[model samples]
Target: MQIVIVLSLLFIAIILFATEKISVDIVTLIMLIVLCTTRIITPEEAFAGFSSDFIVILASIFVLTAALEETGILEFMIARLVKIASRGANILLFLVMLISGTISAFMNNTTVTAMFVSPLMGVSRKLKFSASKILMPLAFASILGGTCTLIGTSTNVAVSGYIDKAGLAPVGMFEISGIGLIIFVVGMLYMMTIGRRLLPNHQDSALTEEYKMQKYITEVLVLPNSPLVNQLVYASDLSKKKFKMLNIIRGKEKFLPDYRTRIQANDILLVEGEIDDLITIRETKGIEIMADVVLEDALQSPDIRLAEILITAHSNLIRHTIREIDFQRRYGLTVLAVSRQGETLRTQISDVKLKLGDLLLVQGAQERLNYLRSNQHLAVLEEFSQVLFRKRKGIITISAFVLAIILGSFSVLPLSISFLGAAVISILTGCISTDRAYEAIDWRLLILIGGMTAFGAAMDKSGAAQFLANGIVDWLAPFGKISVLAGFIFLTVFLTQPMSNAAAALVIVPVALQTAAALDSNPRTFAIAVMLAASVSLVTPFEPSCILVYGPGKYRFSDFLKVGSGLTLILILIIIFMVPVFWPL
Candidate 1:
């Protein structure tokens, strides 16, 4: 009955995760609540996940990564490496993947991809290369690189913690590096050779059109008899209809409009809204929609500009529509359009609920855009031309990070303590503020991992893991030990598409460990394989790193299928053969 109850809850959790009606963190919390209420696990056992060392290590890494980004140290390093990597398209792709994978082994893969997306866009433009060719590789490299270290991804830490709690040897910092390096090399080679040809070559368009914002922005000439001609700009029909009047072009002089500014006859008003709204105003107010004017050109000035911003996981805009939030008044910026799940949405943006990974085209003051760069919610997609690097802060924070790595690697301190200490030093040295540090930690991810840990405990205490493992072992033992190992790897890769990599790995760890024990094989081998398998999910863009690039790369769902499907299969084969040799399953 206890096993049936745990299995039933697990089934429901998987369904909820796939539908995504509720957030993953919420699903995890609900799972915990069910486990405690059913008495399948004690409240103390159900809550033990929150206090795991894995949470501390994962949270600290977020702080350290954010501090590096805030001080511009990570950007500087990437820029220098990219400059040296310039050659032809194939060479550039290889170098990018190589460097990206290496760095991803230490940093969060999403943060690494976010840091590169804008600069890689700039590099692609300079070389006359298609961004579609490089952005996918950048995202893919970061994911592959994460397989190289225990700290490279939260999945590794979570799995290690589970192993320790289950009375097995804990994973070392660099224990997986041998097999991880092989996978990275194979992945880079595959991308440069066969995968490069599969990538799309979408031609580059202008910055405004690139974000598909042209149709939403329009220009109109104010007529002599227009009601808006003599009225304050804030009270005009355009503002009433939610059309943001970006600028007033009076003859050759361009002026930004404010509440006090009044429109004059013959003034050309550049505005952003649905075309239908602009057309309605044009016919009703006797203003002519200037057909020949370039909307992008008129929308720019020394003070006002256009850029792309990504909706991050922590953004307050999630699940809220633009109109409901009164976005313009709240952020002092106008959203021109939005890109989501590889679709460019130009019309009815106000009605669209914002989701994580949505890229927004915005027109605002340079100052506000700069402020948005530091905002945890919105990620600016264009590179800031001005260097904000603080040399002393960068040096101090970097040194602290190195010290933490050394101490953790040499066994002088536990990995969690070392990283947490480094995060403290980073904050104390002023590399980033206290608020920024708090914002940097991906609280949702932490909660998801923490909650899942309890779920794993529930499965163990209720005998669900052993029951499931017995079924798997009976089915696969006929094919031998290698086949049993392959079965777990296949299960993990399949689960990752519907769930987060960390969550999927956590869900499967208890079962895989029990299966290994049943077969008298090395449980660590099964644990490590499951960890690596979660990172090898390249068949879908649902992975956070892949989602970050999907819109910006202008890729289709099929694009990931065509290129990533092949890579995932190849990596799976590599893991099946390579993992056993290292851990001797």
Candidate 2:
């Protein structure tokens, strides 16, 4: 009855996780409560998972990675890497995947992938290659790279801790490097050889080619007796059709037009959009395109173009509005637009206010741009060509991180202590500010992992794990331990397609352990197999890293399925063959 209840709760969690109707962390917490309340598991056992050393280690690693990011170290490394690659689609793809995978082995894969998204798109456009060809491979490489070390991903750490509790020694950092290396090589080779062929070429419709609004912007005259005279700009297609009024010049003064402002006679309107759209507005709305004056005529003498700037936590612009800071006079930049997550900006940027991590689209002279970036606060993303260097702090930050990994792997210190020490050292060395480090840690992921760990513990304590394992053991009795291990690996890989990789691993690990016990086999083997399988979730585009690159790559859902399914099949075979070799069942 406990097994049935646990299984039912597990099924419900999976459904909720996939549907995303509520947060995954909330769902896991609810599962824990249900198990404890129904006497399936004691409260003490249910809450024990939170105190697992694994969660501590995972949290420490997050802080360490955050420190590296705050120091601008990863950005510097990636910039140098992208610049060195030879100018060709195939070569660029190979270099990016290799570098991304290597970095992901140490850093958070999602953050590493996010750091490269914009730069990769810019590089693809400049080189005349399909962004789609490179992005999927990059995402896939990060996934494969997470297998290289125990600290490469949370799943590996969780599995190792669970195995340690089951009376086996925890796996070393490089212990699984052999299989991981093999998988990485195989995956990269497939991408360069076969995967490249499957990716759709979308060079023509690329963002750089299609979204260049510089040529479309022109000043237009709103003449007296025109049909558009005294009409609100919002009432016309200007608002509905996405036409932007850059500025309005009247007599000796010029103003950036507001959406609600009404058009007046002889008003010189600086408008930007496609030529066809501008022509349609001119003809139908009785506005005349100003052919004589350039864009600088209505604004300051210096010309400006829209640029998207990512507001770092350290940025001076945080919480301050354009009016409050006198942004134009103080920073010599005008915030024309801002976008946060998926929302678009409709109000005047200055009046809309600012927040940490907001992506702002600003207009300013190209020369003073670096001033805006270097304030140690804002991360200007428009200039992907320039390499960011933390030359002074790089050696120190890298040394601290390496020392932590070395100490943890050698058992000189627990992973939690090693990483925590490294994070402290980083802050002490001034490589990263304390506040920035705090902000960089992914609290959402930590919460999710913590909650799910508690749920996994409950399942184990309730005899639910043993019951489920007995069923699997009976089902696979005709087959050998190898078949049973392969079954667990395949189950994890399949579940990861629709759900998160960490959640999938958590759900499978207990059952896999139970099955091993039922067969009188080593649970460590099953644990390791499940961990590797969970990390190689390439069969779908739902992963955060994959989604970040999806639209930029112009890839369809079918594209990921077509290429990633093949990769997933190859990885499954590799795991089956390698698991017994390294960790005999």
Candidate 3:
């Protein structure tokens, strides 16, 4: 009965995770409640994972990494890459992967990817190459870099914490670094060669053509006899008809229209609206449509520029429509279009509610666009300036982080204490503020990790892990222990598509450990295999690092399947064959 109950809950959890109707953290918390209610785990046991030392280590790393980012040190490094990339496209691709991969070994892959995305976009635009050519590779390198160390990814730390609780030695900071580096090198090579050809060549087209908005914006001259003359631009017939008054030209004066700006006879107005509505307005409102217009001329001026803003998961703008956002009043930009997955929506874009990974094509003054860079609400994928660096504080943050790593590596202090102390030092040195530090941590990911750790305990407590392991062993024992390990690694890779890498790894670890024990194989070998496998599940853009590039790269879902599928298979083969050599089965 206990096994049945646990299996039922596990089945339900997988479905909920895949459907994504509710947040993953909420699903995890709800699962905990159900387990506690059934007495599968006591309240103390259910919540114990949150209090583990790893939670501290994980949270501290978030702060330390954020401090480094806030110092603009990462941007400074990327700025140098841009200068070097000017020589050639191949050099640009190679340098981006190399630098981003190295940094990801020490920091969160998502943050590392985010730091590089805008700069690469700018680089690709200037070089006149397809952003699709490099963005996917950039994301892949950051992810592969995380396999190099225990602290490289949350999945590694979570698995280490779980194994430690199971009475095995926790993974050393660099214990897996040997095999990890091999994987990173292979992945980098694959992305550079075969994966390069598989990558789509979606050119960086102009915002108007890319968003399908060329037909939506045009100029109309206000006739002398029009009743709309002398009316405020914001209150005119055009505004009532949902036409966005972008710019107004009266005589020789041309400027962005304001609420107070009144229309005058013979004034030429640049407007954005549906083509059908625009045509009707000309007949009904006494305006003359201009001759064939250029999109750049109608939308941009000396003061106005075009850019894309990525809606991050942490962004407060998610779930809110552009109409509700008041982009003009708040960020001083107009929402011209929204891109999600691979589709672009230009019509009714203002009414579309934003979601994680949505790319917004906007038009605004350069200054206002730069302000979006400092705003935590949106990731502006445009001009990045390294002028915000704090040289002294940046050096201090680096010193503190290195000192922490050394102290922890040598066992001079507990790893958690070393990192936490460094995080505090970063704050004291003004590398990052207390509030920004709090925001830096991915609370949902932490919650999922902490809560799912308890679920692992429940699986053990209910003997669900044993039951599943027995079944797997029965099916694969004939082929040998090596086959069993391969089975678990493949399962983890598949599971990571819908669930987070950390969450997927946590779910599979217990079962793999139980299977190892049943077959009298090395449990540590199995545990490490499952952990590494989770990080290499690059068959889709479900990973956060991948999602950050999904829209910006103009990549289709098929693009990942076409490019990442081959690379994921190659990495899996490397892990499967390499694991036994490192730690014999």
* Top model number, lDDT: 3
Question: Estimated TM-score per prediction?
Answer: 0.92, 0.79, 0.94
Tens-digit lDDT track for model 2 on 180-249? Answer: 9899999999999899899888654412123333456777787787776787764644656766556677
Model 1 scores worst on lDDT over the 10 consecutive residues at 381-390
Ranking by TM-score: 3, 1, 2
lDDT of 3 at 499: 82
Off by over 4 Å in 1: 207-218, 223-225, 229-235, 242-246, 256-266, 272-295, 301-304, 312-332, 365-379, 382-386
The clash number for model 1 is: 0
For residues 1-585, could you state the per-residue lDDT of candidate 3 as single tens digits?
888988898788888998888888999999999999999999999989999989999999999988987887777888988898878899999999999898888889888887787878888888888989999999999999999988999999999999999999999889999999999999989988999989999877677788887778888888998888999987898888888877778787777666568999999988888878877766665788894354765677777888889987567787789989877777777777789898888677788878778999888788888777876557888756654878889899999999998998888998999999999999987899999999888888889999999999999999999999999999999999889999999999999877888889999999999999999999999999999999998878888889999998989889999999989999999889999999898
Q: How much lDDT does each candidate structure score?
A: 0.86, 0.74, 0.87
Please identify which of the two predictions, 2 or 3, would achieve the higher lDDT against the true structure.
3
Q: Which ten residues in a row have the lowest lDDT in candidate 2?
A: 204-213
Per-residue error (Å), model 3, residue 134: 1.8
lDDT of 2 at 171: 75
Worst lDDT window (10 residues) for model 3?
291-300
Root-mean-square deviation of every model: 2.6, 6.2, 2.4
